[model samples]
Target: MKKIIILLLAVVAFSFKTKAQTFHVPENYTLKEKADYGKYEDDVIKGIDWLQDTPWPLEEQKRMETNVFLMKWIQGSPTVSIEINGSVAKMTEKNPQLLMTFMGGYTKYALQNKTAFDKNKANQAGVKAVIDKYVVETDHKNNSLLNKLTKIDKDGKLADWMTSDFNKTK
Candidate 1:
């Protein structure tokens, strides 16, 4: 009986291991044509604007991860079970902090992972074009944020500056 139980456990474990899910980046998302290029550029600008409004002591890395999942979810099948890359990825997706996590992360995602998330990369979908420009703009804003962050010495000071900057701009 013990041997049989062990065999059953092994089978279950094997099945779980074999079923471990993997990320399916849609086939070769690349930019093509005048319209696509224009939209992509616009999206990039939008992404940069979003980042400028993000709170200081910027969590750019965290934001990037969230963007990757959002892009994947949107590009992949919406009805399909969104295979979030990790527990954090799942949390970021469902996270209520849209301003910080979702928006900021999306901007990061758009800027950094443009090639992977391009509308033309896979099935030649039209939707992806909307945000392509946003992501591209993010690249510039991302660099700006990094440059500003590097210049600052203290976290508290950075946070204060970011808040002040947002208020001033707003």
Candidate 2:
């Protein structure tokens, strides 16, 4: 009886220790631990492409850079590729994550210098058109997708000051 009780206690302690081994996720994934998570960024890029292909007014790089949410990615230094509707006609060499960065950088560069192709024209023009189309579609249909975006500007008034809701009493 004494030997059995001691053995049971030892098993319980060992089980507790096994269960206490906590998982360790990498820092880039969580910024809390230091584990080598390897390359997971490719999936992120693929996911962005998924977002881009969807009908969310995914404009060309040019216009997206100006938007603050998208701008954050650009400022971070990811490369951008511009596909017209679906064909791969141009790219920014930085990676898709920096589409806005490339867009913003290219726009700034064009403003300072004059080049004909390789993003001089298509990047800026494509981004602007896509963004404009997105905004119009969002407004005309009363889209919730851009509702957060609509409230971003400081004036708030500029987003759509002339709307009927703007003058509502409530």
- When summed lDDT is taken over every stretch of 10 residues in candidate 1, the lowest stretch is 119-128
lDDT value for model 2: 0.36
Task: State the lDDT of candidate 2 residue by residue for 1-170, as single tens digits.
Answer: 99999999999877644433321212234212222111323333332333333333433342242244333332343233333321112221212333443344343333334343456344444343333334544323443422433453234442243232322322
User: Residue 13's C-alpha lDDT in candidate 1?
Assistant: 72
Tens digits of per-residue lDDT for model 1, 82-154: 2222222322233223223333334434445555764222211111222232233433333333334334422
In candidate 2, which residue ranges exceed 4 Å CA deviation? 1-41, 55-72, 78-117, 121-170
- Return the TM-score for each candidate structure: 0.23, 0.24
How much lDDT does each candidate structure score? Answer: 0.36, 0.36
lDDT of 1 at 139: 32
Please give the distance, in angstroms, between residue 65's alpha carbon in candidate 2 and its true position after superposition. 17
What shift in Å separates residue 26 of candidate 2 from its native position after superposition?
12
